[model samples]
Target: MIVCKFGGTSVADAAAISRVVEIITNKQSEQPVVIVSALGGATNLLLDIANKAAGGELLSALQLIEQLRDRHQREAQALLGGSTEAEELSLDISATFDELAHLAEAFRTLGYLTPRSLDAVAAIGELLSSQIVAAAFRHQGHPAVFVDARDVMRTNDFFTKAEPDTDEIRQLAQARLVPLVQQGKIPVMGGFVGATASRVTTTLGRGGSDYSASLIGAAIDATGIEIWTDVDGMLTADPRVIPAAQLIERISFDEAAELAAFGAKVLHPATIAPAVQRGIPVYVYNSRNPGGKGTMIAFDAPRLPVRAIAGKRATTMVKLRSSRMLLAPGFLRRVFEVFETHRTSVDVVTTSEVSVSVTLDDATNLASILQDLAAFGDVSVSPRAGLIAIVGAGISDGSLAIAQAIAALGPIPIHMASLSATGINFTLVIDDDQVIPAMQRLHATFFESAS
Candidate 1:
């Protein structure tokens, strides 16, 4: 069995949904299990409505809901040809909007939007999209089963960002998914949405649809997982920055994860972990060019000298210095404790005998984190920092790669540098203004030959 996940763009309209139908029809022999995200930008619109409702703008929120209803209703009619099934599905979709309206009213009365309430409002996008796609698939004569993910993907009561209970998930899939596959039925489920054991609605965080697909693939022990999205595949550098950036044909799980974490848009950062642990291969394919052989991610890929160069701007660097840290035993530990206390994640760290520097992506809590770190020693926060990572299997062969990187960088001043202990990634810190140029230079130095 194979697991296939289509992103928002793949199912955004009737034409896109038809293309997905063709993809699934071609894979009928593989007994594919399908997962889908919200139709493009629907989740954002839903969130906007939720926020407006929380702010007591019920009329504006209801206007957005009406627009959403019309968009989906039009797509439903176009795809299903306005049959009775299409009419029934339209009512189902309207019911979800009704629920949203009711929730908005409740929030207006309550004068606040809790995380749990927000999740309840947010999950309707995936729910409605999945239902529409399933109906469209059946309309095309495929035996498609609309599996409400809430029934199979059991999670803790975290609401907004619930963590899945793997044991229960595995059990549920083995019992529920296996039979559906045996009957030669294609199971279509919603991504990024789940429910507690008691059936309370919840969601995984943003860009979490990819992670959702991976988790489901792991639970079912599928042969492989495919993520169909808008891009061609993973690229050597951000195309917006480097016009000549080349598509990466194959990458290892670790390399992909590192690139994603550093700002590769092809996949979610957490999407690779569960699949990597299960040794399942993931293919990133283009929904536009369904026939194109996109990037493949697997275990033990051939060692490339440098597979990709990825970077992220809008980062902050924190530098801590004190003579007291030189002989202090738990000084570094204490410094990190402050970040933990503030619920901020540290991306990179470099240290000397008496000084330490760390990079953080979450700048919202910077002030509080700086205050807490100041209690330990002198702390300085540098905003407008960026990080660039060179990812490949042979990144740590020697100091040769680092030397080449620094040479390629030329006069672009690097603020910090660190090589992963496993040697799969070499990261450099630079000013936000230099990130794009550095990525372009490094990509040319390493991947130009392949390009």
Candidate 2:
């Protein structure tokens, strides 16, 4: 069996959904199990509706609901064309909208939106999109079975960012999805949405559909997992930053995970873990250009000096310095405890005997973190920082590769640089404005010159 996951853009509208249908039709021999995200921009619309309603703009929220209802109806009709299944889906879709209206009323009554309530509202898109995708596949004469993901992906009640119970998910997948596949049916599921053990609605965090795919792929012991998105595959650099960035043909699971964690958009950072546990190979492909050669991720891939360069903007850097840390044993823990208390995530770190510097993507808790750290040592905060990462199978251990990177980026001012603990990622913190030019230079040095 193989797991095929299509992203939002792959099922965005009638035309895109049709392309997905064609892809599935051709790949049915693989016993393909399909996973789909919300239609393009559907999740954003749902969240907007919920926020507007809670802010006492029920009228505007309802109006947005109307627009969403119309959009889904149009896409469904264009795909299924007045069939009985289409009619049934229309009712189902309408019922979900009704639930939203009721939820909006509850939000207004409660005067606050809890994480659980927000997840309840956010999950509607995946639910709706999966239903439509299944119906469209069946209309095309394929025996597609739509299974509500909640029934299979049992999770803790963390609500907005629920963690999946893998052991339970494995049991449920074998019992629920295996039977359908054995009976010669295509098992279709929505990604990124699950239910708690108690059956309360919950969501995996944003961009979690890829995580869902990897988990499901591992559970079913699939031979391979395919992530179908808009891009050709993982690229050497962000195309927006380096228009000439070339696609990487294959990557090790560790390298891919490092790139994803740093900022590659092709796959979610969590996507590689479960698949790695099962020794499953994951593939990334373009739904639009299905014939193109895409990237394959596995345990052993050919190592390169530097395979990819990934960067993210809007970062903040924190520096802590004090002589007290010179011979301290638990000083690092004490310093990090402030971040933990505020629930802030530190992205990169570089340290000396008496001073430590860290980069952050979540500045939401910056003020609190700084205030708490002030009690320990002198602290400096720099906003508008950015991170650029060069990923390879042995980037940190490869001194020549690191030398090449520094040589390519010598003109730019780098605030801090650190090699990851596992030695797969070499990250540099710089001014956000230098990201594009730095990426261009690195790509040219590593990829273009090689070509």
Candidate 3:
């Protein structure tokens, strides 16, 4: 069995969804469990409606509702024709919208928009799109079972960023999902939305549908999980920064995860953890051109010193120094404890006898972090920093890779650098504006010149 996940762009309209059906129909024999995201921009629109209503512009919010209703109705009609399936699905879509309209009214009356309320409103996109896609499949003469993901995915009531309970999830997926696939029918699920133990609606944060698919794939112990997005595959570098960026045909799971954690957008950083635990191969493919080889990620693959260059802009670096840290064993531990207390994640770190520097993307907890860190030493924070990470299984190939990476930066000042303990990644923090040029230079040195 294989888990096939389609992102929003792959199911944006009637034509896009039609292509999705074709892909599934071709792979039906593989016992595919289909996962779908919201139609393009639906989540944003739904969230906008909720925000507008909470701000007291119910009229404007309701206008967007009508537009949503029309858009889904048109797509469903186009995909399913005038069949009874299309009409029934149309009404189902409208009914879902009616709930949103009511939610908008409630927000207006309350004059507030809470995270819980926002999740309730935002999750409607996946709910509506999945139902439409399932109906379309049946119209095309395929047996499809629409499973409310909330029924199978159990999470804490964290509202916008609920974390899934794996034990509960595995039991539910086996009991609810396995049978349908065993009976030769496709299990269609809306990705990214789940319910708490008490059934309160919750979202898994942005770009979480990918996480949903990976979790489900692991639960079922499927042969593979395929993530279908706009890009052909993971590339040698960000294509926008390096137009000559070539598709990476294969990579190790650790390398892929490092790239994603640093800056790669094709896969969510959390998407592969569950699958990795289960030792399942995850594939990234393009729905537009399904014939492309895409990229395969697994435990073993061809090892290269520099498989990819990934970088994120708008990062911040924090530096700490003190004489007290000298010969202190727990100094690093205490510094990290401050990060943990504030719930901020440190992406890269390098340390000396009396000083430590770390990079962070989430500054939401910066103020609290700085206050706590000050107890240990002098603390300084630099904003608008960027990180460029070189990911590979061959990172321990001596100093050659590191030298090449720094040489590519040319005259750019490197604020800090570190090689991972596992030797899978080498990272550098620099000014935000220099990220593009740094990436271009690195790509040319490592990829372009090599070709």
Highest TM-score scorer = 2
- Where does candidate 1 stray beyond 4 Å? 449-451
The TM-score, computed over Cα atoms with residue i paired to residue i, of candidate 3 is 0.96
Q: By summed lDDT, which 10 consecutive residues of candidate 3 come out lowest?
A: 340-349
Candidate 2 has its poorest 10 consecutive residues by lDDT at: 390-399
Model 2: CA > 4 A from native? none
Provide the overall lDDT of each model, using Cα atoms, as 2-decimal numbers. Answer: 0.89, 0.91, 0.92
Taking the tens digit of each residue's C-alpha lDDT, what string does model 3 give over 98-211? 988998999999999999999988889898888888988998889998999889889998888889998999999999999999999998999999999888889898888999
Per-model TM-score on C-alpha atoms: 0.95, 0.97, 0.96
> Candidate 1 — what's its lDDT?
0.89
RMSD of each: 1.7, 1.4, 1.6
Give the distance in Å from residue 298's predicted Cα in candidate 1 to where it truly belongs.
1.0
How many angstroms is residue 348 displaced in model 2 relative to the true structure, after the best TM-score fit? 0.7
After the best TM-score superposition of candidate 1, give how far the Cα of residue 344 lies from its true spot, in angstroms.
2.3
Which ten residues in a row are the worst by lDDT in model 1? Answer: 442-451
